[model samples]
Target: MKNRNQSKKPKFIVISEQIISKIISGELLPGEKVPSENELIHNFQVSNTTARKSLQEIESRGYAQRIKGKGTFVLNKTEDHHLVRTLGSIDATRRGFDEGLKVEGFKPKTIVLEKTVLDHGVSAEISGKSYIIEGPVLKVHQLRYADEMLLKDETKYISLKLCPKINMLSTDLSYFKVYEDKYQLKISDIKQNLSAIILPPDDPTNNFEYESALPVFVLDSVVLSRKDAVLELEKSLYRGDKYKFAIIAHPEYNGN
Candidate 1:
């Protein structure tokens, strides 16, 4: 016979996810911080020990960091933070580099019902089943430069339903950091797509076409979670002359 009282309860991750999502939904703000240990204990109906464990884990993962005098501090706010690109480039991870950001624009445009269509003049690069993920998608575009050299231009689209509150987001705020805390949506894996492109006179930004013969590098990455849902579609283009992407991959064995 089954014990009626012994119900398999949900994990702390589930509770933490709900609370964090509310935070990302702008129910919580940057540098605003979260509840104290005691408040979490009462709110989640969990023990003090369990609540502490949840907060500690989230803080450890760079979603938030504990300060000595102050309580836990959220990391999303852009206060001259040095972050890396994580692409297959050594330059991507270089820290302490002089960087600056320009707020191109941040307005809520009515996203069309369907997905993306690459307007590149050349051949259709991305193949079948890789065009776009299924769901509400919101796109964020930015141009990144390494010091005086124009490095790359990036366009990232995240699930809209999961991030409806982004219209109020600032340059200091980070979407991935917020999602990790709120949805417990870990970035379990990422797949990358790379291609080369030629510059033209009327391209976006349309500046500094080298007199030499060379092409730019375009990268498209899709991030997925353990739940098998698509997190974000990131497409970026880089100046090949200024940056070089270096990676070492080895094949294990042939059919032995």
Candidate 2:
């Protein structure tokens, strides 16, 4: 049995997590100044020491650094080999880079390789549920480039029942943006699996025509709507040499 009277997380820890979430979501880009200690104190209703501790935690964790008299600034930790990518829960659903690649001073281009509508009879099993393909299912295949460098290949299967007009929308834009902006749909959750594989030369997915021995990271994902209905299935392949991934876990919380 779980304890009914567990202690809550410390105020400083909670404040640190709030800022970290923004960092992970790319809401706070590298070199941007984080909130000052006074801001944290006022916003979180904590003491000066608590706020200072929170900022210290951020710096110690390598998310930011404090320069005397200039306040703290976000660091581009992704440049380090170990922290190239982060995939986790967030309020916004974004595909490749969070915010935009341009924030990093690179002009990223998203190209639609293919777009088509699939008829019924296509089905897949996820979490023990059989999801049958209904009429006019929208399928999109895309390739992304940053500064003219190949980055990733992505394929998406969107249920027409959820977004019937998806086929009419521009495939060059993010699907989450289209769902929210055009259809006014809110994505509530995501289920994903990550694995690495070396593609054979004859494999159809070797669309980019990479050398046969190159390894890639395959990400399988399902997007869910507010009512827990499946909205989209996505398979994204990322170049392993150019990217790495990290997982950030939050403490398990019990309803009070």
Candidate 3:
């Protein structure tokens, strides 16, 4: 006979996992009513105590909010979906700076408003390399629009040393495309840092047209080539209210 003390699956845990799976799969969206304790007890044929414990577990884990009489509801996804975005593939659908905004019904438009061919030394400083940059080095300032609303402002330092005539490319085109398709440059890696800041109302350098009191997300990144050469330095600001980031973590699995 099997040991009576041997571990057995908790019925409540199984039911909780079922509901969480639905939430993660987007079938149960934020603010939707989750099945109540009574419902779970009736549907799963489990004890009322087991069902109640499961609902408490969900609320304690930040997946749902239990009002005294209003019942349990799913919490906002922003809390559950925030990602570290350290070194890995970010979800393409949630990236703020690209055409992926189309998933949210917003058309992306990048407008290059200024270009300056900086002195060779200035280019070196921005690109983190010696003055061996090929072709012409220029800085381009751009404004990004989503559905005609100013959503992002960007400043890019590009090295045309490897691919001459890159400056002549259209402003709205993706530079990643230019590097891969036009110059056939293999991207080796990218490093990024992110921060949050509130734009001061009196700050003239803040070109984005939004309330100064609102916080914005800033991203600073460097793109590298196959030989570990710095290809570009990008600084961009995104409207915080318009974007969400996601990340996946493995706590037990270690890759060697």
Candidate maximizing lDDT: 2
Q: CA lDDT, every prediction? A: 0.52, 0.73, 0.66
Q: Which candidate, 1 or 2, would have the higher TM-score against the true structure?
A: 2
Model 2 lDDT per residue over 1-256, tens place: 2233222667787788889889889787665568999999899888999999999998888788786776786766565322245564443255335333433335578788889998863555555566555666788888888667667888888989888877987776667877777778888877777889987768976865776667889887777787787788878898777776666677888987
Best by TM-score: 2
Count clashing residue pairs in model 1.
3
- Sort order, lDDT high to low: 2, 3, 1
Report the number of clashing residue pairs per model: 3, 0, 1
The residue ranges of model 3 lying beyond 4 angstroms of the native Cα positions read 1-98, 121-135, 248-256
lDDT of 2 at 190: 71
Candidates ranked by TM-score: 2, 3, 1
User: lDDT of candidate 3 vs native?
Assistant: 0.66
Model 1 per-residue lDDT tens digits across residues 159-246: 6555555544553345565567666777665566677877764565544445555467888766666675676677777776554444
Give RMSD (Å) of candidate 2 vs. truth: 9.3
